[model samples]
Target: MQGDVFQADEHGPAEQPGERLLLDLDGFEGPLDVLLALAREQKVDLAKLSILKLADQYLEFVARVRQHHLDLAAEYLVMAAWLAYLKSRLLLPEPEPEPGEQPTAAEMAEILAFRLRRLEAMQSAGTALMVRPQLGRHFFARGEPEGIVVVTRSLYDVQLFDLLKAYADHVVRTSVRTLHIEAPDLYSVEDALRRLERMLGRMPDWSVLSSYLPAILGDPLKMKSAIASTFIAALELAKQGRVQLRQDGGPYSPIYIKAGGVAA
Candidate 1:
């Protein structure tokens, strides 16, 4: 059933797009919700609307809902009772006031009107937000870059930690035990190079660099001389196409020396 007061103007032949023949109270959240909707539709100021006759309209709407056997909530009934009380209070004449006494009827009406205004404002904001374009709905984020593939390290790459560990091991292995003698002994890179050549002749085709630097495990002076000679010898061999040096896996991996042509 339709409400008489809630019905749109029918004086004009054509009705507006949002104009409805009946008030759909079911669309509202509560009694205040219905009042807010009605006030917004009519563009009525909440504070001024209390002075005008709106209590009867509100009560009639609630009564109609109850008459239709529609399940009305307790809030709706409570609001109806409050509206009846407000109406009665408005009708009665004002009593003689004591000093600084409360203005019950006007204050009550103002408070109710203020609350209704706030509710109406929030409803308007919510409705506006519902219509706005959202992040995922209106526009989507761009997919991550698929073209570029980053490689952190390549095969046989020597990381810093591995290099440091290998150096530390080399230091420990090259440390010499002290031996006292009357005469001081001297070592040379040439002596180390000749020794390395003889060792390589007896060794396999491909051997680790340590195999040619056995002096590192003995005297510290010999170890330094052998290291210098080994570097020069390797360079000379590579130039003459006599030896090839390689390091496989990480930095901790042995430096393998192979006969480029034939070992010197």
Candidate 2:
């Protein structure tokens, strides 16, 4: 039954010398064009034509074309194998479909039809493109010749050392600097200790350490240094058991000092 289906029709219409069909099977253009022509003869739409039904006719056409042009049968054979595979897929029973399965015969046929339609559209577009005028060969731009204009200018090739020297000179000219001389601190810790002793002898009772600071120091900056020196001297006298230091309130409270180590 399969052999009968694939067998060529011996009684089909014969071709005359003047009416021979022009086919370029070597170029592989004949297969698709022949199939389209056959579909048109059956009054069937190219997209809806059953690949299974046309399979036999297409194979027969390829076999006959092969007999006339042996050298050109390679592409035709490949196309035949593809159609034969499609035919077998349609005839054979398919397994139960799982997720992410291959496309069915109907889907494959639709895809083939879409591809054929796209191929036809691309071929038409290609033909239209070939027919249009080409640049530099057919069409040309119209413009006047703007002759070359050359204007020479001078250029200096200065060295990196020269650039550095210029930068240093510019910086020296633009920069402003003032000379500062800081005098040495003449007040000593011994001086601070003696001053504290004299102040305590005058008071001789519990007094805030801030009260020991002079009523008039020379300047605010000098007074800051003097206060620091006095505080250091008080710490030394406390260490020596010569003075008693106490804070009646919290840590941040004023420190009270007296002449003797024994608290009153």
Candidate 3:
């Protein structure tokens, strides 16, 4: 079924042209991505670059992606709006600061810095996923019992960028209509995680996991920030060998957290 789907995609109207999805030494996801890529590729100052041409490219890129990938265009539109808004403002005449209010260069830098940070994160995940060998489990209908598979530390490491992307993707999921069940309040988990985040932490109990989240946020659009923020904090603790996530089996398994980090 999987092969058949791929074959259909290969020959189907949706088939991407050979040159499509291909990244040049610097061809980027969008104008912001392109600027960031160029900055990295050239190893030049991120500031002082002309935003005019880049802003135009940003608009053009959105239109191009829409023609090729409708789904991508929807998500890219958010970035497009941000660029267009910035471009429009930059085109306006400078206004005098009223009284003691001055917009510092640092503020402008931060506005542009977000794109650079996010692009780096996106690139790292793309590289990591590209290197991992494909597992054919989806190609088969069933799997025979096999020996335990062990993965060493070298195999895969998740990054904060990936966590943000995943959380964004998760938030974008459609909300469930069914009632949510949990023994504890979500604010409690948020408090716990936030507290644990400040000090290196441990794995959380698997059961009642929903308590860690706002039940109403089962939908995608609302879950991104909270979940993504939680995700990286957990992993940061794990990286220092200060925290470990433990899951007990069956109904007896107690899902609890522990601290792990250089300090732990």
Candidate 4:
């Protein structure tokens, strides 16, 4: 889970009453993951996830954790604090960032440097990949460069990924739903996968899995489901000694095929 939220009083026994049924916000990947789970749980408008209240509560919860647990969470706590800070700034009616503050030279230089590094790394990676017949491929022919475009934009073009910080902001202003109340299960992997296959007109590569899910489910969710369901089901069946997931097929990845399911 990502930037999720919960009041401190809500989590307890870590299992029996309020546990397992809902994800623990503290167990999230980031503030956004936590926010996404809350949005889905509350059925918040797909357009937004309350970020301010969530970020505030996140920091509060971090402070309240067992003294010992704080050490384990120091890094996460730091990030949570940052989210809360960023959220507060957004709530105020302000013109905008200071003129010079717009992508400071350091930030711009860093971004450019990062892009250059990526290009170089891509070249090196491409070369290394070509050493193995299974890995080599070029979407553009050798010595051909791809076109790049630059664009100016505002937040409306944002995808779910862009909302992590946004969610942290709204969470403070609007209450974040706690999983204290019961919510009926929505999509189980069992049903979700079936729906996905139907949506795609076929079972698809793990990468394509999320495209069939709700936008809130998002691309990252689909990628995760692909990796999880494929491996988990394969593992279960493998224990029964029936099938195994093999990744011998280039970029297509592994599948659980019966011991004799495929013949070379």
* Clashing residue pair totals per candidate (backbone < 3 A): 0, 0, 11, 26
TM-score of 3: 0.30
Q: Extract clashing residue pairs from model 1.
A: none
C-alpha positional error of residue 70 in candidate 2 after TM-score superposition, expressed in Å: 4.3
Q: Which of the predicted structures, 2 or 4, would earn the higher TM-score when compared with the native?
A: 2
User: How does each model score on lDDT?
Assistant: 0.68, 0.70, 0.53, 0.48
**Model 2 accuracy (lDDT, Cα):** 0.70
- Find the 10 residues in a row with the least total lDDT in model 2: 1-10
| Span of 10 residues, lowest total lDDT, candidate 1 | 3-12
> Order the candidates by lDDT, highest first — what do you get?
2, 1, 3, 4
Q: Can you write out model 3's per-residue Cα lDDT over 1-264, one digit (the tens) per residue?
A: 011111111122345445334322123444456557545654544455555555677677557545544444333467677667777767776676677875543355466766676677888999999777666743443467677989777665799999999888788785535797865323333554575566442334232322344444455644555455455555555565756655556765544446542322
For candidate 4, the per-residue lDDT at 215 reads: 38
Q: Residue 65: error of model 1 in Å?
A: 1.2
Tens digits of per-residue lDDT, candidate 4, 26-137, equal 5564444443444445455433434555556656655666442323234456666666656655565545458666553334334433543455466579889777655235
Off by over 4 Å in 4: 1-27, 66-68, 95-98, 103-264
Per-prediction TM-score: 0.43, 0.38, 0.30, 0.26
Best by lDDT: 2
